[model samples]
Target: MRRLVIVNQKGGVGKTTTTANLAAALVRRGWRVLLIDMDPQAHLSIHFGFDPESNEPTIYDVLTQGTSVTEILRDTEEGLRLLPACVDLAAAEVELAGVDDRHYLLRNALSPVENEFDAILVDCAPSLGLLTLNALCAGFEVIIPLQPHFLALQGLMKLGQTVALVRARLNPMLRIAGVVVVMQDSGTLLSAEVISGLEQILAAHRRSGDAWGDARIFSTRIRRNIKLAECPSHQTSIFTYAPKSNGALDYAALADELFGTAAAAPVAPADAAPPVAAATTRDPRDAEDAAPSESSMRTATA
Candidate 1:
């Protein structure tokens, strides 16, 4: 299976949104997918109408209690399955801190059933904590979902260093696949400029042969669409809640771009989203993404 961890230390950058829709999109392409909600916030679980409060067997059980994938997997109407998350997962990092091999818990948990699916997508919490480390150890590649904003830009270098540390100390196969720019505003010049800056950063990393060296900005940028945000509350993916909306078209196109072929061709972009706002030429704040201490990173990689 193609095991991928969708991660970003910054919140509200479309990690859950991308994980939900991308899994849905991949399922539409006839791939059997397993969605793992590693975030204790349970947003991805709630996005699919699964009640995390119902005391279900969650990933928290998997990591902390040794619950098998079958015991916690929730079947969805779209044919995709999920190892759902609960608010109890928030305690996982602290609970597992003293445990031996905590970083490999998730990797070992998936070993039994990983072959049963074509793809496995894990939605990580917005922190560089133990839980996120578990994901890094389990995943073969990292898919970073970024927002087209300067503040979001101010964290990629830090995340890249985290990936480098994890790759050296835990999972050598771990590398970045690419970046997906979400909530893009074609109407805003700042958004365009942010993307340009992102491209330059990725280009520089490629030259450095760092952990994210191959990470490129995906061609299918997620346009700002109100429907994308609204669908989560409705407890379904954009494909199901607003199939003909701009949100649906963009995600569909992105699915096709990421996966070789999709079962459903993207329909024409719809007008269901809010009208693009007029471009306001504002300069993005020039902030820096703090990398890990050179000594620590070098020690890890050495």
Candidate 2:
């Protein structure tokens, strides 16, 4: 199975949205997709209309109690299968702190059923904690959701450092497969400048033949859309809630690119204007501090 972890250390960057819609889009194409929500806030679970408070066993049980993954799995109306999350997962980091194989618990738990699906997408919390580490250890590929803002870009280096550590100490196969730009306000010069700066950085890294050589900024950018933000509250994906909307169109294009499938529909042009370099400047220290702490990470989301 193609295991991909959707993560961004800084929150509110459309990490959960990317995970949910990408899984839904892949399932629509007849791929068996399994979504695992590692976020303690349970937003992804609630996005699918499942109450995290319900008595169902969550990924928390699988990690802490060693419960079999198949036992807690649920099928959604959107043709996607989910291994849900709950607010109780917030205690997992503390619970796992004493375990010898703490970082690999998720990887071991998923071994029995990894072959059942064609693709598995893991939705992570907004912190670089034990939970996110488990996810990085379990998956070979990562998709980072980024907002076009100076503060968001500042956390990229920290995330890159963490991924590098995981690759060296845990999963050598792990690699950043793609960088997705989301919640872009096309009218803002700040947004445009941020995107330009990111492109230049990626280009420089590629030229230097660094680890980022294989990572490309996705051609399909998720434009700011009310409908996309509304779908989660309505408990459905963009494809089902507003298939004709621009939000749906962008995600469809993203899915096509991710799956290496022929584009069934032409990608929409980016709505953004040219960037103003001055508007994109920020203090790097302030940007680094924007990442959530473990105490506050549970509430982080897109």
Candidate 3:
């Protein structure tokens, strides 16, 4: 299975939206997908109509109270399984501070049920706290959701440094999958300039052998779509809310690039092992062909 963490410290860049839609798109292509909401806001849960205040077991229970992932698992109408979160999850960092090897909590909790799904994507909050650290530890591939703007570019260099630190000290197999440009406005000169700036920085990282060496800006730019923002209020994925919308088309194209297609889906064992054991035979895609070429990026996005 592909264990991915969709993360970015910058808010309003579409991390949660990308995670939700990407999982839905993957499921639509015949893969069983699981979503883990590591964010304390529980926005991911609410996107699927899950009640954070319904008194049901949640990811907070699993993190602090030793609840199994299956206990809190909820099925979406669109075939995705979710590990919902709530406001109470915000306290876990403080609660887990005193524990031994706190970083491994998520990696450990996932081993038991990871084999049941073809993909597991974690939605992290807009911080580099303990919660996000746990996600970095558990995930093998990191997918960064970026916005093509000058201010947005500043945070990526810092985020890349954090990922490098974590890879060296926490998870060696961890690598950046790619950057998905969201809320894109292709007609703006600022968008083109920001994308060019991104290319230069990433190329430098590659030459310097940094954490973002294998990363690239995916060509599938999620255009500004009101339906994407609207779907969350209706408690459903964009695919189900507006199948013919730009939001759905963009995310579906992303899913195709990431997992290929139904006939040639991502290659992983049906009954895969845990992160520690599975790291030995890491996915080749994790470290290959993701670096974006300037010409190709422009050809596709322009």
Candidate 4:
């Protein structure tokens, strides 16, 4: 299965929204999709009608307690299956702190069911902690959702650095699939400027050629749509909430663009042996101070 991690250290850039809609769109296109919510907030689960307060098993249990992923998996509309998250996941960092090979905990948990899904989308938390590390180690393709803002560019840089580190240490096959601009308003001058800057950066990297192998910026920009924000409140995807809405159309285009090129490749087998020593480093947050408030979830929905 092709594992795609929808990640952005900046929360408001629409990572969760992209994960939800993209999975829905892929399901519509006849792919078996698995959506994994790695955020402690459980926003993805709640968006799909899961209540963390209930007694049902969550991704927290699957990763920390070795619960079977198939047992906790639940089907959604349009044939997407979700591995829900709960608030307890917030404590996983401390709980797994002293454990060995903590970084590969998630990868080990998901290894058994890797072949069950055609596509696995991981919705990561806003911070660069154990949870996000798990996602980086588990997935081969990284899909960064960016907003058209100067600060978002900085966040993207940090995320790119993290991905590079992960590749150097953990997963050698990991690569950035592409960068996606979300909540774009083409009519605004600021948005236009950010777009220009992004293109310049991408073009420079292309000229260098060695920095990025095959990664390219996606052409389908996701426009700000009220329908997209509204759908999560009703626990539905944009397609089910309003199929004709711009939100649905944009996500469908993105899905088409993503799968049209990579659909035929077979999923990689899970890592059977235990992870090596490098994956067990302490939390990156403890070494440095917490990310600035502006870089955290402050702009989560913007």
Candidate 5:
């Protein structure tokens, strides 16, 4: 099974939205998908129609109490299964603080059921804390959802550094599958400039034969669509809420681009290696800036 972590330290970049919709799109295409909500906010669970207050056996129990992920997995309308989250998860950081190998806790928790689904998408919190580190170490590929803003690119650099550190010290097989630009407003000149800047950075990385060699910038950008923002309130995916809308189409295209038939050709395990590290060293200030700001969007019911 291929594990993908939807991560971005910067909030408001559509990480949860992308994770929810991508899982939905993959399910619509006949893939068995499991979405693991690693975020303590439980936004993903709520988006999938689960009530956070229900105190159902959630990912919190699965991670801390050694509960089975299968028990927590809830089937959604579109055939997507979600490993629900609860507010109790917020205490995990403090609870698991003294535990040994905290970063590998998630990896160990998920290893048993790794083969149960075709794809496992982890919706990480907007931080490079223990939770995000666990998600990074647990997954084989990282999918960063970026917003086309001046500071978005800066956050990507910091996230890239953290990924590199994880790869170098923990998960040797981890690689960046792609950078997805989400909530993109094509009509804005700033958005256009950000896109061009991303293109140039990607191009330079491609040429450097460094940490970002295999990393790709997805061609299918997720445009800003009201339908996407509205679906979560109704506890539905874009596919079920507005299949013909731009939001649905973009995610479908993204799914196709992620795991297409041509790219399915199997190769020897020995041939797979982590992407080369980027030559760009991360500035410490970048990390501070990439951290979730106080004004970060909270998961609030409308």
Candidate 6:
């Protein structure tokens, strides 16, 4: 199975959105996907209509109470499974601070069922705390969801450093697969500049024998779409909520790119239930920016 962590220390960078939708996209390609929500906010869980307050055993229990992950896995209408999270997870960092092998908690928990899915996507918290560290230890590939802003650009360097530290101290096989720019506005010059900066940064890392040495800035950039921001409120993925929207199209292309395949032959059932009404709105943000023409799109062959 391909174990990947969708992470960004910078908030509102679309990590949760990416995790939720990418898993759905992969499932449409007929790949079994397992989503692990590591964020204390439980947005990923809530996005799938699993209310965290239902007094169910969650990832927090798996990590702190010696509960099995399989016991808490829940199936979603999107054809993907999830190890949900709850608000009580916010205390896990402090609770496990003094625990031995705290960093490997998630890695160990996932080992038993590693073969059950084609991909396991971990939705990490925005902060670089113990929760994020556990995700770093558990996942082999890191897909960073970035928004086009100067501060978000700076946060990439810090996140890269965190990945480097984790690689050295915990999981040596950990690598950044690629970056997906989210909430992008292709018409903005600043967006293009941010993508240019990212290419330069990634190129530099590739030259330095870093974790992202083989990484590329993915060509399939997620476009700014209100449909994407609104899907979670409807408790479904973009593909399910607005299959004809730009958000669904972009994510489908992204899934195809990730798997080295053409557009996915739709595998969803014809009688699948229609999505619920979209009501709430997230704070709008820019999606992925442009990829420089000269930027390396191929992963450097090891």
Q: Of the candidates shown, which would achieve the greatest lDDT relative to the real structure?
A: 6
After superposition, candidate 5 runs with Cα above 4 Å error: 207-210, 261-302
Query: Comparing 3 and 5 by TM-score, which wins?
Result: 3
Candidate 5, residues 1-302, lDDT tens digits: the string is 77999998876679999999888766655567889899888899999899989968998898789898778878887678888888888788888899899899888987777777788999998788888888999999999888876666776677778888898899988988889988776566767887888888778778554456688889888877678889999899987887666677778778778876313423313433221122123233322213233344233211
In terms of TM-score, which candidate is stronger, 2 or 5?
A: 2
Tens-place lDDT per residue, model 6, 1-302, is: 68899988877788999999888877766677899999999999999999999999999999999799899999998788999999999999999999999999999998898887878999998899999999999999999988775555776788899999999999998999999988776566767998999999988888677887888898888877778889999999998888767688778777767764533333434553333222222223323223324222221111
Tens digits of per-residue lDDT for model 1 on 111-206?
Answer: 998888888899999898999999999998899987766566777789999999999899999999999987776556666887888888888878
User: What lDDT tens digits, residue by residue, belong to model 4 across residues 1-302?
Assistant: 78998888877779999999988876665567889999989999999988988979998898788898889999875567999999999999888888888888888988888887888999999888899999989998999888876666776666777887888888877888888888875466666787787777667666443324566789888877678889999899988887766677778778767876223324423432211111112333432212223333234332
Cα miss at 200, model 2 (Å)? 3.0
The C-alpha local distance difference test score for the whole of candidate 2 amounts to 0.80
List candidate 6 stretches off by more than 4 Å. 262-302
Provide TM-scores for the models: 0.85, 0.85, 0.86, 0.84, 0.84, 0.86
Error of 1 at 162 (Å): 0.5
Task: Report the lDDT of model 3 for residue 88.
Answer: 88
Query: What is candidate 3's TM-score against the reference?
Result: 0.86
RMSD of each: 9.6, 9.7, 9.3, 11.7, 10.2, 7.8
lDDT of 2 by residue, 1-302 (tens): 68999989877888899999888777766677899999998999999988999978999999999999999898888777899999989999999899999999999999898888888899999899999999999998889988876566777878877887898889988988879988765556766787888787777777543445578898887766667789998899988887766667778778877775532322322441211111112233432223333232123342
Candidate 5 Cα deviation (angstroms), residue 268: 24
Worst 10 residues of 1 by lDDT: 293-302
Using TM-score as the yardstick, the better of models 1 and 3 is 3
Clashing pairs in 2: none
TM-score of candidate 4 against the unseen true structure: 0.84
Give the candidates in order of lDDT, highest first. Answer: 6, 3, 2, 1, 5, 4
Clashes of each: 0, 0, 0, 3, 5, 8
